[model samples]
Target: MTDYTSMANGGLPRISPYQAGKPIEEVQRELGLSEVIKLASNENPFGMSKKAVAKCAEALNSSHIYPDSNGYYLKQKLFEKFGYDPKTITLGDGSNELINLIFQTFINNKVNVVIPAYSFVVYPMEATVADAQVKTIPLKDWVIDLDAVYDAIDSNTRMVVLANPANPTGTAVNINKLKEFVKKVPHETLVVIDEAYNEYQKEEDFDDTAKWIAECPNLIVSRTFSKAYGLAGLRIGYMVSNEEIASLVNRLRAPFNVNAIALTAAIEALDDTDHLKMVVAENAKERDRYVKYCEDHNLYMIPSQANFVSIDFKRDAFPIYDALLHRGVIVRPLKGYKLDTILRISIGTHVENTKLFKALDEILKSLK
Candidate 1:
């Protein structure tokens, strides 16, 4: 047999696959535990909205038909809800697909993309896939340093990718700072803000990119139904941008990229205000409770505006993660993000949070 690895692009060697949180079923089987709580992946602990569920069931009756290639109904509903022109919208299998499509639309080997150092890892990976250079700006005080990011931009910079309520840290930049950065960026460069956790933002000064995108033609805001909407399994996300840019992105997208059920579910999920409110409220309460627990336990944690928290155990987080897993609890270890002493935990239900705290308390006691 021939070795196929040699035929691959040289740049492919530089890419590291994204690591998602471990599944609860796998952990349960491995540990032989009947019950397990997964406080990982930043997933909404509350189940999906009833309206979305009903719509999905309705879609099942037409499961034999292909999804609307243009995602017409969902786009129309999104336009009505968000007030963006339908022509400016582009749907994706998920926000991840939207990230990849952005590179496909605008990137070339000669172009370079700028990203925050500790922001979403997908930005760098997508740039690498496009064979484009990546300039990573390190975060200052656990928040994106807009000044530093501005300094990194140059004539060759084609895109700047930022994740508000950034993952692994959950910090957000102020509206004034983000607006100034947007104003200073060159017109030729595309500014992409990944707002996957926008619904969870609690800060008063959080930048609303939707409002700014109206003035900045080069801006793109990516959002998903996975977080507060509780539709991760369906993999539906969309990008709002200038009509011209959206056209380019649409050209790069696969036909029927979103499934029939997902399109229907997402449209219904938008009308689920009660479910959205409940998730937002529960997440806020659990997040505060977790933060308090961290403080009381003397574990240093970053102040988060999202549903997840990153806590520094002042020791190797891997051992604690393994211990938690053995106890039927799953949390994300941040070793790959270069924070070996930290673990990221998503906000769960009150009962789940109690179990996590109990497991951690026991683990900490054993460690000492």
Candidate 2:
């Protein structure tokens, strides 16, 4: 038989699979734990809105039909709720898929992509997968170095990614700073902002990229139902850009790329402002609690506007993470992000937060 693996593209073998936060079932199966509180994946612990649930059930009746290829009703709702023109929207299976789609449409071996380092892992991964030239610039003080990013751009640069309220670290730059960076970018180069946690940010912290696209035609802002809407299982997200960019990007999208159930859930989830408000408000409370805990205990943590906090454990975070797992709690360890001493903890409900700290205290005691 032929060696099929050797026949594949050289870069195909180099891709590392994404590590999602452990599922509740996986923990139960592996450890036989019944009462697990997972704060690993920045999930909405409050669960989805009742309105979205009802819409999902209604969508089941028409399960035999294909989803609307353009996500018409969802886009219509988005236009009404957010006031963006329909021509500016491009729907995807998730913002992850949208990220891939954007690269697929613009990238080639001839041009390079400028990745904002320690941001989303997918940005660099996709650039590598496409065999596009990749240039990575590291963070300064755990925040994206926009000045360095601007300096890296050249005639060969096709795209530059900026993750607002960046993942893992969960820090956001101010609006004026963001505008200064965007204004400096070349008009021909695409500037993409991954805003998965935009809804979780305070009004003052948010840059409102939805409004920015109108004036900056080269901008593409991607968001998901997975974060604040509690629809990760549904896998729906959308991209916002000017008509020209969206039109080009949509050409590369597959028909019925988004499922009917996800569409229904996202559409109804928009109207559940009360449910969204509750989720964001609860997240803010837990985030503040963790910040205070860090201050009182002399533990260092990033001041986050996103739904999670990154704590510096002053040593390897893996042992703490494993100990927490054994105690029926789960939090993220950032070894993959090359921060072995830092653990990123997603905001949970009041009960879940209490359980996590209790586990941490016990584990730290045992280790000492």
Candidate 3:
């Protein structure tokens, strides 16, 4: 037999593929259960706006033709809504793809990428794929240590990944501290802030990094339609950077990276501000409910600004996660994030959230 592994990229063998939360069908199929609820992937349970769906339907007529390679109309819509320069924005299949492009564009074996330990799994995976030596700074408590991340920088550091309202942990650094860190970072190194859950943040005066793009040439802020906009299936996302860096990132992006239907839906999604607000509001209420459950049950929850809450079980959570699966519900296990005792639960609809607590209560009681 051919040695296919030998022919693959050197990083392929070292990489563990990203583990997405299990889909509802997969749970039913494997467990032979009729009812299943998935609160695993941090998707908006409210779904996207009716207008976005209508726009998607309208766009189907043009599906035979290729989507605009440049994503012109969507870019214009983004500009009008947010006032970001079209030249400084670049669209992608998802922020995930744009992340890979950033790594491919600037990373190399000679340089290193700084990341917070137990943060997003993608940063380390991409850094390894780019063959860049990764320098991971462990989180302080559950939040990214901005100062330590600053300390990790050196002449060979080409990029740093910062997730605001960070995943898994769902905490964020103070804006003032983040600004100070930005000043300390060498202007030559790119600071990539992955804000996949930006909309869910309820903090007053949350940093709008898009406005920082011009002054901070090295800043790259990425946002997606997957969460608050309920476009996870569409996989549409984009980044904000100075024109030069955006140009470089664009060079690595494939033509027509976002499809026509996605672009149309994204454009319409922006116009449906009410729907976005409704989703964000619902998330806040549900996240609070999860927090209350944790408090009442003696579990510790990392105060979250994102769509999920990371609860420390204070013991191995694998059995709990496995048990929850059999009960016809799915939540994210954080073993891959090096937090084996924590489970990250995405804020779902009221029914889904209540079901989770019900199952968890029974599981915890049995364990006791």
lDDT of residue 79 for candidate 1: 79
- Candidate 2, residues 130-236, lDDT tens digits: the string is 78889998888888888899999999999999889899889887778888888778889999999999998879877668788767888999999999999988899
**Residue-pair clash count for candidate 1:** 0
- In what order do the candidates fall by TM-score, top score first? 3, 1, 2
Model 2 is weakest, by summed lDDT over 10 consecutive residues, at: 5-14
What RMSD does each model have against the real structure?
Answer: 1.2, 1.3, 1.1
Q: List the lowest-lDDT window of 10 residues for candidate 3.
A: 5-14
- Show where candidate 2 strays beyond 4 Å: none
Candidate 1: clashing pairs of residues = none
Report clashes for each candidate as comma-separated counts. 0, 0, 0
- After superposition of all CA atoms, the RMSD between model 1 and the true structure is 1.2
Which residue pairs in model 2 clash with each other?
none
Candidate 1, residues 186-220, lDDT tens digits: the string is 88999999999989887686655877877888889
lDDT of 3 by residue, 292-318 (tens): 899899999998999988899999999
Better model by lDDT, 2 or 3? 3
List the global CA lDDT of all models: 0.89, 0.89, 0.89
Candidate 2 lDDT for residue 53: 98
